[model samples]
Target: MSDDPYGVDVVACKSRQQRLLAEMVEHGLEWVVLTRRESVQWLTGAYVGPLFAPAAAMNTEGRVTLVLPSRKTSLTVAADEVLPYEEKWCSTLRDEQRAASNTVMMSALPIKLRHVGGEWSQLGPDLLADCEGNVINIEPTIFRLRRQKDNDELRMLRRANDANRAMYKLAREIVEPGVNELDVYNELHAVAVQKLGEALTYFGQDFRSNARGGLPRDRKIEAGELYILDLGVGFRGYYSDNARTLAVGGEPSAKQVLAWERVSEVFPLVESTVRPGASCKQLFEEVQSLLDKSKPWVFNHHLGHGVGLAPHEGPHLNPSWDDTFAEGEFFTAEPGLYHEELRAGVRLEENYVVTATGCEKLTDYPLGL
Candidate 1:
């Protein structure tokens, strides 16, 4: 398997670094220290593991120390440790061969007198206290910069969407009346891992008789139950999420049919409302208006949410979502209707990218049941 499976373009990574550096300067942050795994990857394309270990340590000690310097516009990580397989991947920054031990990595910073931005949870207090300069919290500034999607990010997202659709197609063939939820799960899991040769970051199967039945306690799938498969497969570190609700037997009941139709009708409406200058809140309100009040309990969630390297990102589509949709931003529009007493639910989710004119759907999953 290729090391850089996400196929990140180096030019894109460099552009992101430059853009973030400029933003940092604009935000009055001289330098930002990155201890969170996602922040580090998003900023420098550094593939260090998650902060689970540090989180465990923090729970015990109450603090962790981390040191950061001003955004290094021209800095490049050492290439010696980077595997040969990864060398094939394109990167914008020059690759160095120098290796620094963990103990001295922080002290090696070029600037000695600068304020740093970082998360306190990942960086222990001891490290923070040991740092030589002023420390600043720049989480909000960093989040704002990372939240927006760029061209290269969109390309990678498209690739992720392609893989997600392929996996979904393989999964659909395995669904049948006698199939257990776990059975379906195992089949889909194999298709993803064996055919895709990648790990699934998120995969959930919830079987319910009615929308109000709540999530399933077990993974088993039984006939007569409604199967909801919400899955996300990770390529490199990027994630693609999509969910579908299916009826096991021949056809669904009238309520299920109506629920599916409503979701289908609402999805396009949500998509049509997305654009560079559109308001997420406005789109949400329009969708609510289309819902039949007699079935007020059908939908239990927001219209949609953004997706990227993480399964969930920004530019949430909800009544209270205040973020304005920007060109090149990507998100999901998953509208659903459910009734627990009726043992029925219908939900259709699709990933989309906001364009200059409107939006583009990423996932090609059919809207029909």
Candidate 2:
């Protein structure tokens, strides 16, 4: 039986492969080797490793390599850890044209390999020797192509956000005084598992408070504390991340309400100005202006960032980045504030996809006290 929770979208996978092949042809390369876990997952609709694990896990001790030829013939080498999913992996290896083709799976890299990308530092001596000077770094090319979301990718993202909404709602109901952070994390994870079944690769939930710099611990939730719940979940190799701040015990104080209002108001302002041809830096600056830096409850990071196959992707909301927002790209708008003296931290984040005229929201969870 296949362990995958979501069904593979053959059409989307093929479209991605066709785009990749076009890039390879443009660069005059015969074959492209995908070593990065994200690149591999993007090309093939297969979930290879644990969602939270880094690409290194897939590169260690006989890395799981996928070699693609210009002709759409693909090869997948599975590590010992992934051998059990051999049949399912093979089933996901057909060409982008929807033709019935056999996928070659092996335990190790071939002694004589031609082109390679990603994991250059982890290749075997023999394989590296063959691909020494000819290795092509397809990272940049793949990243550019992966920026836009196809119809299928958008659907998967929507589903992932659905789970995210459920998680935040559960957090609001369960988070209260006398509860440990871990206790809330466990309940949220259980809800994710029940909703996603085999598809839930990782349930990433951080339950922290202004008590200890937002670090999770067995510490009990106390009255008048601001709790931050940053939650994420992976669906079919795609990820959804959203966060919210809550007020514990009775109503929030005047300063706490002000911090929450400022953080909450920035997102809609940022969202309103998001459209094609808008500069990311300009949006970031606009968000920064809304923050009361003179106050102690202010965050120091960029206003927001792109979210997709990886938690943090391209089109960063930073002053240094001049990249303009484009249609079909997804991003997260997060504005946060923390006050040490008041023991209050307020953060709000939501997902949006850039469209021709404007943008569409992927996550619609209510954000308030």
Candidate 3:
């Protein structure tokens, strides 16, 4: 039995490498090195921690070489060749890991060509020196290509968001008066582990009570307070971003109900306005207009953002970046209002994948207040 957590499809990773090789050929580049944490995982499917960074070098001829710590050799990866370097062994320690990594990187990618394509900013000093200070930054191009979802990527993302559905249902059950937000956070984590049948590679986003959004605080939640749980979950390298809000007690004030109703209306509005080639900036402005005209409760945040390896990816529904929606892209639409008067406000978010016509919502939890 292959105990590969997250069920990473090796075939898909091979396709991703082919895509990058095509990109290198288009740019007239000989080789490309990827060292960014996300890039390493995206290309090779081996999750490296912050302490060490892995590098993937792909040639235009579809040859990919990965350099990672020797300890992680048992993990499955999608590289034609792997250059393993030492880090630590038994009780003894090796202080020469970085130097060893640099040496292997030099052997892995000895190209000092002028037309090199790689993540220039994320390079280690040793790897940077080997690139000869002329590596062109192709991060944007890679991110652009990432917007389109593959079947394997979608499968992994759905498994992650499925955990979100279970957690949100539990949130509705457990959020009540005098309950600590931290306790709720812990309970949700437990629910996720139960649902996924394994440990989560990532679980984040807001978990707070009587507040707009933040990490779960130690304070107890009062009855009439709003508890917002914006879930950002990761199964392997893929992530699912969605949110749900619950009234602390079973009962909600009239105004609180009204705020929930108004916030809930934004979802349909978003669904109708979103499609392939739709302007994200215009979508933000239009949605903001709808919420602004509704009075005191405000939608003061990015309307939505794409979800993938990074929680906040491109095709953003915000004014900062004028991105347009693309078919096969996964994203989130979050509309909210924060005020101590309405028991610290209400927010509702949903994850969706853009379809040929409109969008298919990934999260199916109840949207009740």
Q: How accurate locally, in lDDT, is each candidate?
A: 0.58, 0.66, 0.81
User: What is the Cα root-mean-square deviation between model 1 and the actual structure?
Assistant: 8.3
Off by more than 4 A, model 3? 1-5, 91-99, 130-133
TM-score of each: 0.79, 0.79, 0.93
lDDT of 1 by residue, 117-155 (tens): 657655655434554666767566656666678776776
Instruction: Give the runs in model 1 whose Cα sits over 4 Å from its true position.
Output: 1-5, 51-102, 130-134, 201-224, 292-296
Best-fitting candidate, scored by lDDT:
3
| Each candidate's clash count | 18, 0, 0
lDDT of 3: 0.81
Of candidate 1, the 10-residue stretch with the lowest lDDT total is: 53-62
Error of 2 at 28 (Å): 2.4
Count clashing pairs, candidate 2: 0
